[model samples]
Target: MAPVTAVTEATRSWDPYERGCPSRDLLDRIGDKWSILVLGELAQHGTARFTQLRKRLEGVSEKMLTQTLRALERDGLVLRTVHAEVPVRVEYELTALGQTLREPLKVLTQWSMRHTTDVLAARERFDGRAGAV
Candidate 1:
């Protein structure tokens, strides 16, 4: 056991490219297509099983989902539990740290959806201008 001490030094900011940085690993984990969707699902529905995740995420491959869940579990973001029953069952959920990311992820999702029309308009304008030139 150790006693706690107070200090007054500034903490470093997260840079995703630094060598052996947890931030970089974190970015890699959350930047994947499946990770975002999985996290979104868990945030919305709480704990879920593999079957449920696959069904809700539509079009996600079993292999990819398994890989993503394993990676998340390794990174301490997701928890995987197995139950011994007639047919064996497994569930996944966000840890406390993982839950914290939900707010930012939700904001990012909302931003994209809310501005989809604007994004489409921008794309159209760019394509139209490119064609005109």
Candidate 2:
């Protein structure tokens, strides 16, 4: 196994378009549906419990939600807090870095809401043309 090397500012590449760039992985993390939704929810509502997230996200399974939360927490985008109580309460909130994503994600969400019908029409047109050929 190769020894791990520290990436300094001078050595780091910021271009996500470049293959093998670390930013590509970061893009992949933030670009996913569940991650975007989770981040948006956290940004909107502040802190939320596991069940609250699951209920809001709808169609997300228990396992998928758990995995998504873990990944977000691991990436330092989400902070998980466990309350010391008989029921063992847990909650998640966006970190400062994660908070920065709110605007961009909100833009994307608004674009989707605004253009969904247009996108569906385009898909239909493409499919119709393809069927004729």
Candidate 3:
């Protein structure tokens, strides 16, 4: 579970570079690669089942998706809805707070899309080889 924070709102101390702070925690939860992808998928699709989320997010393992969803839910950013029926069904959707993150994530998406080819060329030049990863 993510630690409950006493501080809220933007302030001078909210820099992510400083160690051991609420801003850092927030970054780890929402700004990491997996979390951003998950949020993007949710934002685009509205509500999705576990299998659907997994399918939408290519290359994500079951464990990572599960962990990300749990963390988001615990932080009150994502809503988890379970349907009680013959076979239980679960779905995930972004809460209002989560929706607020969409614009920031979109900026990241734009940055990556704009720079990915240049980044790859730079990496190739640095390594003197293609596809070193």
What lDDT score belongs to each candidate, Candidate 1 first?
0.90, 0.95, 0.89
TM-score of 3: 0.82
Cα displacement (angstroms), candidate 3, residue 64, comes to 1.3
A best-first ranking of the candidates according to their lDDT comes to 2, 1, 3
Assess every candidate by TM-score: 0.82, 0.90, 0.82
Error of 3 at 127 (Å): 1.8
Which sections of candidate 2 miss by over 4 Å? 1-7
1-133 per-residue lDDT for model 1 (tens digits) = 8996664334656666778877877787897889999998999899999999999999999999999999999988899989998799899999998999899999989998999999999999999999999
Model 2, position 127, has a per-residue lDDT of 100
Q: Report the number of backbone clashes for model 3.
A: 0
lDDT tens readout by residue for model 3, 19-103 = 7767789877887788899899898789999999998889999999999999999988899999997699999999999999988
Query: What tens digits encode model 2's per-residue C-alpha lDDT throughout 67-122?
Result: 98999999999999999998999999999989999999999999999999999999
Of candidates 2 and 1, the better by TM-score: 2
> How large is the C-alpha RMSD of every model relative to the true structure?
4.7, 5.3, 6.9
lDDT of 3: 0.89
